[model samples]
Target chain A: MHELSIVFHIIKTIEQVGEENKLEHVNSVTLEVGEVSAVIDEYLGDCWKWAADRSELLKGARLVIEKLPAVTMCETCERTYATVQYGRICPYCGSERTYLLSGREINIKEIEVG
Target chain B: MQNNSIDVICAAAGSGRMEHFMKEVKILEIKKSVFEDNDREADALRGELHEKGIFLLNLMSSPGSGKTTTLLRTIEALKDRLKIAVMEADIDSDVDAHAIAGAGVKAIQLHTGGMCHLDAGMTRQGLEGLEAAEADLVVLENVGNLVCPAEFDTGAVKNAMILSVPEGHDKPLKYPLMFEVCDVVLINKIDVLPYFDFDLEKCREYVRMRNPEAEIIPICAKTGEGIDAWADWILREVAAWKADK
Candidate 1:
């Protein structure tokens, strides 16, 4: 799964930040995931466990994930709906042409350090 | 501030510590994208493509969507008329590279090593190795996936989506963004139309319902049916882009 590589990036980023700030360890890492993003949450958590276990900087650190739903803006009723459905359409207007307002995110929000 | 102030004097000192127990905690606010570096890298790559006048097309679909076949056919048809190059993304196999190498143009095979999609960072690396020296048309055949590839932008001018008849007409509805974001939609396997229940009109309507301006071209790459039309569409696009510059 691509989660492994993405997890590696997160690990590398944390280490870089740690090294720059002269921190000994990271307590927790948080991520905001977009609904359409191809990340499997459980897989990412499992992968993080394996990766964090071997490294001194991330030993036993908590992995937190927040999901962001794909926002479908209705052209007819002008309403927005949160949906994970692929080919997401506005629930109110039933418009297939709605713009996705948010979601599809993959980013580290913040890391708690000691 | 009293460190040992018990809320209820009736309870014991340790048991009356409701102030510490029910204390509200505030989270540190730091807004940042986990994919910030990736998106920034992709945006830079897009800038490069725009400057070079390279008509980059990130072709996507399932494993047997005729992705390599379509490129081969395109090379055979367009190499003489225009300069063409290919960047093929795969996990481990170089069979597609070997096949495309001798086809009479510069082709680079990028081994993703189990990566499902090609992000801008990897694509930028791949382009560094790719021969854009004697090339004008650049095509990136992504790792044949419908989900992951849709999330990342590889700095391509257009996302050429290959929808084979065997994949069913509902594919457009299922993979909506893939169909919606595509500049051109090529429906392959039209030669098998008689044996299958794939409705051409229904698919056109389906794509239009999502994106009205998207161009749909039905083709049978195996038999060369509608191949000229497909080639013509690509060439015309390249010409229009070149003229704009």
Candidate 2:
């Protein structure tokens, strides 16, 4: 699954940070995931639990996810709307010139250490 | 007096243990994107390729979409003019590599070990395995999937994907990211277009909607039709890439 690869990348990034900070143990990791990032939170958590425990630093570390809502900006109408509610087309002008404003992010915000 | 002082210090430590524990817990701020590392690696690899004057094309598509056949045709067409090599990536198979080697070119197979896609690091390893430094062009035949491969950059100079006639025209709409990332979309298996209800114009429109800059080339790899244009595209790209530096 793609989630497994994502988890592997996360571990690699965290390991680099751990080395730089000389961290003994990571208590938790907080992530800011977007609403339309195509990553299922449950699957990510499951994959994280299975893969994280294999690493010494991330073993038993809690995963906290913060969801960012999807918004689309209409180029023609210059109006923004919820992407989940109306996709691609602007509701005000029915124009197809629209692009995503956000909601595709997968970032590591912070880590709790002890 | 020493024994009374030791007792007082022990009582203080016992009462302050909770506060010390609380103080030990610290939050470290690290605001970073998950793809930042891979993207950096990919950019570095691109720079290295540019200095070496080698053009790398990352080819992606759904399974059974004629990716290997198109590669074979491409190699056959450009083998004499350019020093070309290939890296075939799959879950578990050396069949494609064997086929390419049989075509009289340097070829290597990369197993993803059950992973669906290859990242920049994996691509670099494959390039090293193929000893592709001497080659003018190296094509990375990425794992046959439309979704995961698009999300990961393989350090290629350009990305291309094949959408056969049988796969229908709505694929761009269904897999928007795949179409968006591709520099060119090869519409393969046009020989069977008469039998299927596939509309070429409609497909072009959909792809344009997703990516107006994407070049569409219709071809039938089996019949060797429209391959010259594809080969010419590569020729121009390789020349441009080498000349830009």
Candidate 3:
């Protein structure tokens, strides 16, 4: 539901970033969305095209989404790995505890403009 | 000689003006987020909330998701143990405050003047003149919505949501963030299960799919069924949070 609105914000930001760099038009935008950031990736992509097509500077801009896996740092081994299954336990060390490192990320990494 | 020189200068000026007007290039570069400026304010609000040891809870749900009822019950249950208060955000109504006050809790209402969602600055302002300054827990009953409220981060310590059984089990699938960002989930309206086709296990399953670690507590506000257990769970969380802070 918020996909279209978020896409609009992303497009607007891209335009500003492009203009700041003196670019004529945005060709592509790279957004790194964490697997656990509560954002629907497929829906985001769908909303991206519809929103980008309306803008003058960002019209037809490609939305490239980089899906990030949920990772946690092990308390015992101090190693980080994808949290494939449920539970905050470390995958390798089998420790009952671990800190969540990076999974909830919604970021605009870079933009390519002409 | 002076008249000839003046005539020549006027002709040159006219030609130059014409050249400047004909087919000049367009700059064609200006794009910016209408709300990018709001993001920084939102971040600052989050930091401020954390620094003050305020465990902020932004409660979101459908209109009839028992938000106010649950809050009234919560305030009644947890008042003595925790320094708690309520901030109600609405388009234009003071009814929520009246209801919260009826339950014997400090209440403040913020009218958005028709804005759909509550922003960080509005939240900070809403907190003013309230008795929650030394509060351990502060709850914000967000504008009754499943969409716009999910987008704005009111610098809350935790975002919680309610999904009444009558609203259906497919809600998590439809409104994922309301379930995803939630640190706790209260599956409200369980008393109507006999009259409706709502499933407790199924509802939990749906939420778990979106967010595995989400704690789900099923309760019926109208009948006071299972409210104590749910309330106990929340109070424990608040106690734990205060200790951590």
Using DockQ as the measure, the top candidate is 2
lDDT of 3 at A30: 71
**Docking level for model 2:** acceptable
Per-residue alpha-carbon lDDT of candidate 2 for residues B114-221, written as tens digits (9 for 90 to 100): 999999999999999999889999999999999889988889999999999999998998888899999999999999999998999999999998889999999999
Candidate 3 residues A1-114, lDDT tens each?
356656756765665555544557767777877677656888888888787888888888788888778787776898887765644556687874455577666666555544
lDDT of model 2 at residue A81? 97
Instruction: For candidate 2, list the clashing residue pairs, or say none.
Output: none
Kept native contacts, as fractions per model, are: 0.38, 0.70, 0.06
Give the better candidate number (1 or 3) by lDDT: 1
**Which stretches of model 3 miss by more than 4 angstroms?**
A1-114, B1-39, B129-131
**DockQ category of candidate 1:** acceptable
Q: Note the residue pairs that clash in candidate 3.
A: A16-B31
Listed in order, each prediction's TM-score against the native is: 0.83, 0.91, 0.62
Against the true structure, candidate 2 reaches a TM-score of 0.91
- In candidate 2, what are the lDDT values of residues A18-66, reduced to their tens digit? 7755679999988999888868999999999999999999999999999
- Model 1: runs farther than 4 Å from truth? A12-24, A52-59, A82-100, B1-28, B240-245
Which 10 consecutive residues of model 1 chain B have the lowest summed lDDT? B9-18
